[model samples]
Target: MNANLQRVIVLSLLILLMAATRSHVFSHFTPVPDASWAVFFIGGFYLRNWSRWAFPLLMVLAVAIDYAVITNQGMSFWSHYCVSPGYWFLVPAHLAMWVGGFWLRRNYSGASVASLARLAFSFVAATALCHLLAQGGFYWLSNSVAEPTFAGWAKNYGDWFAPYLQGTAMFVTLAALAQVVGEQISRHAHPFARRMKH
Candidate 1:
């Protein structure tokens, strides 16, 4: 397949995955955790060359999904609890994840212990930065908190940080495993295919 075509197919799949799992829109039918964070990370790794368009497209899709879900629940988009001035901070937060993946792609040198270490470090750093921006914005600027203080923010950040990191890590780990398996299958299949052709 053409490289561009492959990228397009991958991007489409990522978009579909994000749309399907971003919220409880279909929770009654099937419960699935949100894949938004992992989608952005994977997108950054696989579609980095198309970031000029891909990132914004994914960001818009995320906001659109949130809007649909909130409105579907019979709540106004702006009036929803999650929608606040700080909600816009998600742009930077998610961008951090994308940047992390981009860095990982740049440093990736195939399957090796060093590469695995880089992956772990990159993901943890990115998740930490993402949580900082997202949670800090929500806590300090959202007005949802009553009399916010540094202590309160610290507590709030600490409370949710681990869960968010764990969730993102879970999806990212699964994606990494899938990529490794796909590469292995492709590597083994190509030789067989060529031999059959000969």
Candidate 2:
């Protein structure tokens, strides 16, 4: 396939995955877990060349999905609990995830132990930064907290960090496995195609 066509296919799949899994209500009714974070990360890795348009597109999609869900629940989008001044901070928070994948792509050499280590480190670092910006913005600026303090923020971050990390890691790992399998198949297929052409 043409490289651009492959990118479009990947981008479409990522968007579909995000849309399908982003809503808590949707996920609650379905077996699929939220793949929003993974979508951004994978998008950064595979669609980095199109980041200028793709990132903003995904961000808009995310906000639009949130709006739909909140309004569908009979709540005004602006009046919803999750929609606050701090909600806009999600831009930076999610950018961190994108950057992580971008970094990984830049450093990725192949499917090797060293590359896998880099992937682990980059992903965890990105997840940590993303969570800090997201949780800090909510704790300090959202007004949802009655008595926000450093200690309270620390505890809140601690409570949610593991689950978010685990979830993102699970999806990323699955993507990694799929990529390896695809590469192996392509490698075998290319040799056969070349022989057939001769």
Candidate 3:
């Protein structure tokens, strides 16, 4: 019934949901968009203290999930080399998302709803940056594997841009909802769970 405990539980569920959706819902039926960054954003805001540990920890888990899924797809670990160019940009892109979370923490308040909206906006901006960088990375990297012409590479990047945009939009929307869900859980906790002041 502790507020802190409640926040942890809600965040864990969000991370799990994002993971499952990433592998199942998005990989299959429709592009669910990678909402995992939203989980990291929540984790960043959930704690009032050090993100040096929390942000990196969350990122590690996400990478593990990516590795697990990619391995299951029949790619060898070393085969990651094949996509090194794309992964290079992806690393910074993801780090940007976590960094965005850290930035939003400056204005976070458990007692206010608009705080959630602010968080969502920060995430959207970060996601957009991620998409742009990732697209360029993939285009540049994938060329070595297939040796596409410049036009071909540009077309390839353009083709996949929609999915990234959709995923970013979904992530932002879900993150806003997750904030309310976190707040509601906090509300039901014991007396020690008073909303932290800004």
* Model 2 agreement with the true structure over 1-198: per-residue lDDT tens digits: 788998999899998888888987333345666778888888888888999999999999999999998889898999876778888988999999999999999998678889889889989999999989888888888877988989999999999888788877888999899888888898899999999999
Decreasing lDDT order of the candidates: 2, 1, 3
Q: lDDT of candidate 1 vs native?
A: 0.86
RMSD of each: 2.6, 1.8, 5.3
Q: Give the whole-model CA lDDT for all candidates, comma-separated.
A: 0.86, 0.87, 0.65
Could you tell me every candidate's TM-score relative to the true structure? 0.91, 0.94, 0.67
Error of 2 at 64 (Å): 0.1
Give the winner by TM-score: 2
Candidate 2 has which clashing residue pairs, if any? Answer: none
Better of 2 and 3 by lDDT: 2
Tens-place lDDT digits, model 1, residues 1-198: 687998899899998988878876325234466778888888888889999999999999999999999888898999876778989999999899999998999988676789889999999998899889988988888867879999999998998888778777888998889878877898899999999999
Q: Please list the residue runs of candidate 3 whose C-alpha ends up more than 4 Å from where it truly belongs after superposition.
A: 1-3, 24-31, 47-50, 80-82, 109-120, 143-159, 181-198
Comparing 1 with 3 on TM-score, the higher-scoring candidate is: 1
Give the per-residue lDDT of model 3 (tens digit) for 95-176: 6766677678787677466875776588777766766676668667654546657787667657776666576567556666
Candidate 1 segments exceeding 4 Å error: 25-31, 193-198
By summed lDDT, the worst window of 10 consecutive residues in model 2 runs over 25-34
Q: Compare candidates 1 and 2 on TM-score and give the better one.
A: 2
Please tell me which model should have the higher TM-score, number 2 or number 3.
Answer: 2
